[model samples]
Target: MINRRDALRASGLATFGALALGAVDAGLTPAEATASGQLRGWTPLPDPAAGGVTSPPFPKNLTAEERRNLKTFDELDFTVFSSADWARLDESHAKHVRVHWPDGHYTDGIQKHIDDLAALFVWAPDTNIQVHPLRVAKGNLTAVTGVMRGTFSAPMPDGKGGYIEPTGRQYAINMATVGLWNRRGTMDEEFLFWDNQTFYSQIGL
Candidate 1:
């Protein structure tokens, strides 16, 4: 029988795909659109740091540093998210739950799905946002992936043309590489996570 978890997985993937198409339509290149695809699924790729290989260009006003990040990790594994970002992700989960034969925890709102994982994934509500990491599954042998929501294109603060706007591009990265989960299985080791932050300004917002 198709279980609740399976239903949720299918719904999340479909919804996230649709959301990704919407993002590309908003202004992302085919590559930017596919960046989210990498989160849900991974294939061996040519190194992103390779030369003459930039993703679709962003608005032309971001700072040298911001632009670099936009190119390097923008489409890298999405395992990063912020506090508000994660809360908003719950909104997506809530919506998909109804369509996917959700469990009582979702439909009845009894679960209060918000937690530190979700919270850390949200944007910092400031120009600079922290990219927090979370494991989608314990001891996952393969990979876990998901899509962050969409964001509007705005000029960046560093004299760039695009800003990594909050309330948008909320992250949806699941464990992809076995590297994160294999060695650590206990809660005590969770402290090993690294905190990476991305800062930017809105150019045209």
Candidate 2:
């Protein structure tokens, strides 16, 4: 069984990957994007020193698919921070969630999922992900795009026990995820894609 921590972590990676693709379309190399200190029309990456919420509040009116998509982001942005939030996953995800990441890695069950999330935070302590308004929702599928911005301050682990040294540079990249919901109205599987090379190249990893 996937633990609550794994489920939250897995969701964060998938969500970040899916939303990062938007950076590629913007014609900004991850380095170029962070160098400018903005993401063009998208919201500016939050200043870690100046603390404030960057993600918009969930809209009052939403389509079924949109609500589901928003739930995923909420889990990453809000619920994952607290142990109590694990219950939120039960309401929004299956016990046996499956995840696919951009690096062609796969994980099932919750414990593996939590491990991914832990690895990510370890590399970028102040990383932040937010949803953009542009979303597509149809039936059991929903796609939300956004940006992930953070400074690579510590050695990042490769999951194989190796680690990538931080370049001490910040990165802003586009991400997008297509979520598949089970019959229970929860996300069962997610397909995530982002420019790993772009991210690595930006951070000089």
Index of the highest-lDDT prediction: 2
| Model 2: per-residue Cα lDDT over 1-205, one tens digit each | 8443344346765444433344344332232445657654454556322334345444434566667766765565444523334435556557688887888787896556666665666878777664353354444655655566788999987768898778899887776666677667777876666789988888886
Per-candidate TM equals 0.22, 0.61
Cα lDDT tens digits for candidate 1, 61-180: 344543443332332333223333443433223321222112212222312333423333333332222221211221211112222222333322333644444334332212111111
Q: Which ten residues in a row have the lowest lDDT in candidate 1?
A: 186-195
Task: Quote model 1's TM-score.
Answer: 0.22
Clashes of 2: 15
Each model's lDDT comes to 0.28, 0.61
Candidate of highest TM-score: 2
